[model samples]
Target: MPIRVKLDDMLHERRLTLSELSARVDITLANLSVLKTGKAKAIRFSTLEAICRELDCKPGDILDYSAED
Candidate 1:
């Protein structure tokens, strides 16, 4: 996928664990894990907003795009 989930990097930068973020965002650990691992197929806008709210970051901080060869 050209779009990459940079959730792990954002968590690291914020000194937060997946479990911590899950609790703060009121999301299941499994779902957050999927996103963190870049295995998720899609994300709800509400979910994105929750993550951004807890992480104090913009959407671009968690997602990136790159051209695939």
Candidate 2:
């Protein structure tokens, strides 16, 4: 996928575990893991907002787009 999720990098930079992020975002581990691994097909704005607010980051910090080769 050209669009990628940078959640792992953000979590690493913030020194946070997926469990911690899940708690803060009120999202389940399975779902968060899906997102973190870039396997999720879509993300709701409210969910993204909650994550960004807890992580103190913008949506760009977690999401990126690259042209497909």
lDDT of 1 at 54: 95
Q: What is the C-alpha local distance difference test score of each model?
A: 0.95, 0.96
TM-scores, each model vs. reference: 0.97, 0.97
> Model 1, which residues run further than 4 Å from truth?
none
Candidate 2 lowest-lDDT run of ten: 20-29
The alpha-carbon deviation from the true structure for residue 46 of candidate 2, after best TM-score superposition, in angstroms, is: 0.8
lDDT string for model 2 (1-69, tens) is 999999999999999999999998899999999999999999999999999999999999999999999
Which regions of candidate 2 fall more than 4 Å away from where they truly are? none
Candidate 2: global Cα-lDDT? Answer: 0.96
Candidate RMSDs in Å, in order, are: 0.5, 0.5
lDDT of 1 by residue, 1-69 (tens): 999999999988999999999999999999999998889999999999999999999999999999999
